[model samples]
Target: MPGKRPLNAAIIPSAKRERKAITLDIKLEVLRRFEVGEKLSQIAKALGLAVSTVATIRDNKEKIKASSQVTTPLRASRLTRHRSAVMENMERLLSVWLEDQSQRNVPMSVSAIQEKAKSLFDDLQRQQGESSQTEKFSASKGWFVRFKERHCLPHFKVNSTSPGSNADTYPDVLKSLIEEGEYTSRQVFNVDETGLYWKRMPEGMFISVEEKAEPGFKSSKDRLMLLLGGNAAGDFKLKPLLVYRSEDPEALKGYSKPNLPVIWRSNKKAWATRAIFHEWFTYFFCPAVEKYCAQNNLTNKALLILDSAPCHPVNLSDLSDNVRVEYLQDSTADSMQPMGQGVASIFKAHYLRRIFEHILEATDGEDKATIREFWRNYDIVDAVDNIAVAWEELKPATMNSVWKKIWPECVHFQSFSQTDNIAWLQRNIMALAKNVAFEEVVEADVGRLLQSHEEDLSNEELMQLERERAVGEGENEDAPPALRQLTTEALSVAFSHFEAGLQILTSNSPDEEWKFKVSRAINDAINCYRELYNEKKRRSKQLS
Candidate 1:
């Protein structure tokens, strides 16, 4: 019963719709741009966002980042509106539940998953004393679909796994590859991939709270995949493939990818994906084998043994007849895998020792208090080189002994002395830790860390840890300018690093053989230093 007001009295709706909630990724982009000296207006215009929106993102990034992530949808989303924690808690628990079910071989039907998600969401809400919100979780098919994709779970297809009984037939298959294909033990190869947490120390080094902090550094999550392969005769070992958690790490900027010390690859997860596996087989594995066979005067014949991982590429379409790819029967890895015998263990043991060696090498002669600072520079780029060296150190004996359980026919000698070798490595490890490193290390500390360096990770941990490093991570750091060139200072640092390694080896060499080895190393290093020094002197003369 009221008449329309005049134009001046007319009310106007707010022009700014409650701006759509900015996502974590957008927030990150804003922050990254700001750090690189971009103006607020530039960032805003580039992203097609308001200047104030960009400013808010930059201002509240740190506080907002800790709470918001892609995994937790925006507060504006209907599902997570007023109860983001409920969604987060539910997602984490359901993720674990789904994984447990998968491990138990329970069928994960889409409808079944949806029901579970809804139940878990309901249970979480009650636990959080928010049951009165009156908004029930449907875990609707649409939401479930997105969630499944986000977790990288394959479509609703149930995996049909049959009990494997053809394990005994594997020998006959190998015989056919050898007798029919005429591939020798040297040409017959078995490859396997393993995960390593390079940063994890033994449990004794830290308390449970510190070691397993939920939001802190998870050694279990900081992982790399080593794709290792060797023949039964141990006469040939493929160049190891090392995958790290970066595409173009700043630590590796100066190095040419073609001349990398190892076959390097990267992904967020640092895992060997199907595409990566195929690429390796076609390019690296095939060429390497072809070259090896040429040197051995054998036909271009090769056989590859693999495990039954779904992600493993089964087809070798690129190299058809010359190479035969065969997968081991399911449930036969522990008993039949050539890699399981001792190749992987030897590789891992050496890999870890070399890591500590590099750390010691890098920190050599630095002040005791400044020792920790040097450790920061030893990133995955350095770790890759160390890993390559470690893989090369694998003794033929250890590589050949791997066939004992699967193909004893190929084992010429017993691996009993492996224990003695490991003990020796442990002793040297202790020596290096105490003599070279700032801290003292015991045999147990050395053993546990090296032994457990590759934890038997659950499938979920494998996926989570394989996620790519954050956006700004692989970029160069603000401090500790990148060492791109071999300057005079670089030469001196190299010598110092080598000197520390020499001292440790000198102290730990068990016998005359070992002592002679260390002495030879010292002479070689000094000769190298002299060569560099002379080269530098000549360069200076030319300049003058």
Candidate 2:
């Protein structure tokens, strides 16, 4: 017999209430925070989730992260669902391609993405030797709709802005803020990243040089990204941040990353990511600025100006109380961003000039083996040293002059003529190129090489980059080598060399004042090492 129903049974709710579904995006965010040492309760409160749910997500983090590898992490907001292996492979490759394009600031269209998907699927099928009976991928509009929602293409903005539209208005707005805040030139800084084919020469130059020497020589397309920044005053330049394809390249073995001339970081593509930028801001940028402010007797407050790059996180302002971050107008980067307004160009010219200088120096005696070794051993380490030298070559006035377009008031009046002249640099570079036996290289070739860094990757190049990334899979990024302790013996030997060199110079010199000045400079430079040597001696004695 059926049980008698209650009078209000129709209006009564079921005993078990439906639980709210937590999207994959939220779970991923929770995992990121957890990995970064955030407390479970804090993450729960921040995301408006229960502590239990946060804990559950943390427990299942490995699964969640593995699932995200199949698609874009941020775009996978929906619940996890099973996907075929072929589709996963295609989408994963497609995501990497999309990210690469975004990093280069290349715009994407729906048709283009659809076409790329189909092509990637075809490539995957050929590689796997799949049977024709395998399910076909249409890459139709419906699939794209789902893909777009899943990956968050264009990162929620179809386009940033019409090119150069905000050039005039943005400056005025920034000027008003600068005035209101009473920010000095020293308080404002600008940063931007650019691609560098670190080991490669001008387009065909490398191929020609390499082919003549060795049949096995291959043109190196290896690239790295550099982040350069400086205060408007130009008195303070931040150490460049270098992102490379491999964190631990063979040439850089046994080097302490912290002591590197640049802030070193890496990923498979060598493109700067949000996490990398955030890490830089927190650890390197803030501490350096604080120390600079203290030494210069300026207020600790600072204003960091950035372009609308996809790598920069929106929460940059929340990272530091003393440092304020502002973004320049979108699409107007070419016209209004201080770094793009001649600064980056000048830096690139300096870097190129250094490369040419190295080649000439290496081939001065025309030693074939030396030149071959130079070409072979020229790796990230060499590139890094050259980058440091080139950066040092930038005059303060040149740095200040770059602000003239974006904020004229911030620019100091000075003779910035010589170092900032792009044409002069090009002439010097051309001279060096000819000296290095690149007789056909011209000023126009140098110009084109600089422009190539900003150009979009071609289809073939993109495929090659994807293949390189695939080859790097399953390998963890190696941590930088630990700082090696200075030994008393090494310190003493280094000092002996310095003293000997100074004595030799002093003896050879005829001018008394010049000798005295050189000796004084050498002594001053080695003073820090002298102290370290003494400290090491004291420690040895105590241990004994």
Candidate 3:
């Protein structure tokens, strides 16, 4: 052709290409332009990258942001090398080891790090039933250096005791801040995340004995990670973030993403991770904190407290000067976290209570004997809705009292305590459970429901959860599928709700305009349904 371009690396016109190392600023700017309605190809060309690179940025924005967290105010490169060793698995393993070592006051050397990495990899290979290599991966000095930098790991000499061991210093630090007037009660917030088996009963009471003996008795094992954020004063509460285990859970199949009731996210493992945490900080926590401060006429300064969980970002960058993060000492969160004090338990009680209330409502004023039949169909969607309800129902008074230990000055007098609320839940939940389950079972469940939640996720369990599994694929889900296929009786029940609303409009409205519109909508719907039904019947006869 017109002096064919020198075949430099032979542009083969194939899908395969080397991944580019894009700078964080470039990726972010591309997304900003996308939000402002610029074309991806245009943005890519301007940035001197392929259009597909721009598209990738748009597609996995959260992943990109997490990978790119800055170290020293530099726009760090976020691009990661494609490798057989899954970074997610590696991050979790290394983080757990680091935290454990930190708590033990043990400093890690480069060689030590390599040894651990090799051990972890070997163990994983054995678990996966892959033949072990004749020689283990070297995890060489260069690799260790890169790994340490990538994870922001420090290699200083051990001088002081572990964070877990030096419990006294943490309280001293917090108390000093209060005495110094560094932050007010309203400005102090404790944010902690915990796993919840949303559909789980206190026991396997939901499972039949036959089903339990048959195989997987995990019908109620649906889990979610709930991040609760609340101030010591309890005057303001940030909306809780719920992270479910699937990319697109069946419960959220038809919902509009932008109009969700909660700041929701998802991961394969329902457990929390740094990537998810970073996204939460950047998008949900920062904006909400700013809004809360602005509305309350409070100073913009806020102190957010977090525990040293493995998934928390090593350096949460770009937070404004007014916002500061304080990590709680290791092993002391149980004693120090405000959310742990009572807020989480209270919310869980209220969540269970909400579910019971739902069960009651579903009964339609029927005898309690029918509660069992009506309650069997509750799913993840019901649990999620109840989670929001439970979080909202926690009284400010109850939440404020939880901070009494550390922030006694901020603690205001309240008529009731968490104990009273727990008693109430136990009483009510026990009564409700008895109506549907065995009395002995109810007792066991009620005890469990009231107890503090446990963290029992093992490493292997987490690794198993991280493995990719296709969920609800290939099933033909109908577009515009009704919330549920309506029964004639159910339809009649629904009409009563509509009729009640229409009657209110008729009685309260100044004119017939509202009534006319509703009537027209119903007629149009009925006529369309009739036409569709007739066409379906005609097609069926022709096919026969």
Candidate 4:
């Protein structure tokens, strides 16, 4: 009976074939009437969609979920409190260690203390069960070690049981002597000798080159032994004192030069003569001070500050009542000597500068004779020349201005609130003045010598010129023979010799060191020039 009803022709025809699907936007007006807060089931039923699809969209909606492991405000505060407590405990432990060492004169080894503390702390932590699981009390161990080292070791001093001598009277004695006018201005002088050598290398320039294996490589054998004397006015009187020994005892017999002592032979094979010391004081130091005082109409009471050099001996009987010796404490020159702070540094700086500059300038001359003369004759004239040049460059206001700048820097005096030693004060002032003036003179002398030696171009310069000439001429098949020969001769003579000199200077053999190398290089250059001249003469004759 149901089959009797006929199906619609268009709808029934699609059953035999698949049809394309289309989507359409729906109006929510009908669906809005479903419920006040519509359940997904009710909304899906009204929309004619599956309950599963609506439930899927509802489940996917963003929702905030709190974690069970979150760090709350209370937890954070607890952590901070724990850290502070641990740090405080560590500091307390360190303080105990320091106080124990200070109170007890016993010294405890750091490693022993660290191990003991670490074991005790670790055990305490283990019993608590709330111990740091990562590592048990690392901060405590570190603090224990550092506390013992920095605070404890330096405070320990050896106690002396023996009765000490009353050595404090020396200062009082010295003060009395100074107040009594024992040291007159001119007679009170400082005498000292400084050893200078060519081995004095410039700071930052004394490089240890690996390829050059020589030990004690010096630039030259040239050296000077100068004895410098100065009174309270800072006037420098220098003498070249030579120290040598003669096998014959008769050779050491009484003889004296203007500023030098006669050769003194020794009875002891291992030591220099006692007479050398006697000679230094009797002939050089005492006479200089006495003469200076006599010339200036000053008293002969002089105070001398000297080191315990074997060459400088003290005899209370021989010394005049006015003359006194102030023996400085060993290794305390840095704090005690006025020269150590001021004059020495300035003198060395100027001295080295002049010496090096003189060496460089002298090397520029073509003739060996000229170079030799310049090197040997570096005395008063050299000093004057160098000083003039240095002064010119410095632009110092005047001699008085120079003195004013140098005096305060060189002299050290106690304040009026404290008693000052008059003898030391006078001596330092004079020493400062003399050193500054002497340095100036040396600088002036070097400058004048350098000025005189200045020429158009040296042999090395001429070689460079020739090289430039060849380069500028370009690639010419038939360049002038004379021009080519001149250039070749110049280069061949200068370069080969200079190369040899450089090699010798940088050699490893101790005997063939820099000094010897420089000498050889100079000789080679001279020889090369001679050969070039001879070859030129031969060519000239052949051409004729």
Best by TM-score: 2
lDDT by residue (tens digit), candidate 3, 402-460: 87766667888555578888888778877775664435456556567545244344344
Provide C-alpha RMSD values for all models, in order: 14.3, 11.2, 16.6, 35.3
Which residue ranges in model 2 land beyond 4 Å of their true spot? 1-92, 104-143, 149-156, 160-164, 206-219, 329-334, 366-369, 413-420, 475-544
Q: Which stretches of candidate 4 lie over 4 Å from their true place?
A: 1-173, 203-227, 236-274, 316-322, 331-334, 364-544
lDDT of 4 at 138: 58
lDDT of 1 at 472: 45
lDDT at residue 186 of model 4 (Cα atoms): 39
| TM-score ranking, best first | 2, 1, 3, 4
The models' CA-based lDDT, in order, is 0.66, 0.76, 0.64, 0.40
To one decimal, what is the Cα RMSD in angstroms of model 3 from the true structure?
16.6
After the best TM-score superposition of candidate 4, give how far the Cα of residue 352 lies from its true spot, in angstroms: 1.1
List clashing residue pairs in candidate 2. none
What clash pairs does model 1 have? 268-467, 268-468, 269-466
Candidate whose lDDT is highest: 2
Model 1 lDDT per residue over 20-91, tens place: 556556676677567645578868987889988888788886775565544545542532233355665566
Pitting candidate 3 against candidate 4, the one with the higher TM-score is 3
* Decoy 1 TM-score against native: 0.58
Show how many residue pairs clash in every candidate, following the order shown: 3, 0, 0, 22
Over the stretch 1-544, how does candidate 2's per-residue lDDT look in tens digits? 9999887565566678544557667787787667645578868988888999999998887888888878765555443434455566677678777877676555567787889899888877776675633868989999998887756665622454554477778778888878877788998999988887776567557544654465432335667899998999988899999998777888888999978999998867788888888888876788788778888998888889887678888888897888989887555665777776676778888998998788767767744445566776677888899999999998888888888877887777555663449889998898887777777786777888877777655444555675675565455433332334568888888988998998899899999999999999888656656865886799789999
